[model samples]
Target: MIAGGERTLNVVCVKWGDKYPAYYVNRLYSGVTRYLDRPFSFHCFTDNGDDIDPRVRLHDLPVEPFESELQAAMQRKGRKGAWRKISLFRPGLGGMEGQILGFDLDVVITGRLEPLVDAAPDKVAMRHEWRYEWKGQPGGHGSVFVFDPALHRYLYNDFAADPVGSVERNKGSEQYYTSMSAFRRGQLHYLPGSMVCSFKYDAARIPPLNLMMEPRLPLDCRVMCFHGSPKMEEAVEGFEAGLLRSTRPASWLKRHWRV
Candidate 1:
């Protein structure tokens, strides 16, 4: 919906504080450019734009109108920017009027993104949560998601009215609140699991299996999500920690995380 009939696919990612360097944004832009053939804009919503690539459209991180639900959850966990991602729900985010694809800095794009985004064009598009709950209510993952800023404005308005209540009801997960809010309105649909594989379940190897095979990428996966680690860097560096420990090398991750 611009001049000359050109389609705009606004790919957006957010960065705050020092968790991810600005270079991560640049790499994301590079990956997007490699796979997406259409005319598009890659935006970095960040607190500090000093080190980011000039090609990336840097916009200051949008502010929340009130206390965010994620902030309340983070107060006990001692983490910041947990709710910063939700700020993108603001109408016409960064003044870009089009469908938006939100990505976490840690994600690696593996294939063309158009199919999934176009699949549920009239609704919110997202991947399923950490697990596939066949018998229970559905949940969404925030690592990669798509929505229309102008149409899905209710998610922001309702949450702003009662951030605490929203947090408590969704069990303090912004992902849950985000998807459920749209789901109720019949405006949320999930991308196929084969298209958005998780590093932990799909790629990482267990002790006995680490010797059997290396991490395998799904043939149809468009994006690889590194939820709850090892993170993209950890996977690239070949290490795992805590309960999800695995020392097996993730050479494939290192190869894809950048290009």
Candidate 2:
């Protein structure tokens, strides 16, 4: 529990390799510092902490115990699975206990985050994928998630026993697999669509009209995630991929993504 009536919001993110620079974490921390009113702790599970801001706590990346299983799973899918995020379920991360809010490094924190921390205080909360299909299957986008690490340790244990089996059960989607764990315990819930949304699905407007006006922010969306092309960094500097492009001068990205 956090002191002084404020909730202890533990916001975490992960990174490995150099795909994204350290400033992504820095800017995200800066955004959290700017918008969140409650006392919060920021953590980054990363391979290297070199250009990261001093305010953000860093931890070494978690090692996968089932490397052979991981490789087999990836080979079966013909693509890499984001099974690494499964590590978040490991016990006692950063010694936090109340609420664990996970943010992908490529997301832009746009507004107050007290809602994500407060809305479903005792459940595993995350965004629902609007564009995917799986019969009787719930698609949980992995960009943002909230749960207690200690309470969810079984996820890591089960995966340790058979990583490929776990992936196969969820069609190789780590997000869905994670949600299934929460669902099994009757603690699965989706963050309000307005609380966590996507940049590509919600923000990327169809263009010549895009030439005239900027993409309007989603109603009450606190964070917008950039899952694919035109990452936060690319969006900040004005993104253009083939014919699909957000017009030049992406000032909105600079406002939130840059702090």
RMSD for each model, in Å, please? 2.5, 2.6
Score each candidate by Cα lDDT. Answer: 0.78, 0.77
Give the winner by lDDT: 1
Deviation of model 2 at 218, angstroms: 2.3
Query: On residues 1-259, what C-alpha lDDT tens digit does candidate 1 reach at each position?
Result: 5589755888999888898887778878888888777778888888899978888898987767674544655676533335777778887778788788889888888888878778888788888786645546687878889888788889888878887677777767788888889889888898888898888887877666654466677889899987776777777766645434664677776666673
Residues 56-109 of candidate 2: C-alpha lDDT, one tens digit per residue: 889888767787777678787444446778877877755756668888887888
Q: Once superposed on the true structure, which residue ranges of model 2 sit more than 4 Å away at CA?
A: 1-7, 133-137, 242-248
Kindly give the number of clashing pairs for every candidate.
0, 0
Instruction: Give all TM-scores, in the order shown.
Output: 0.90, 0.88
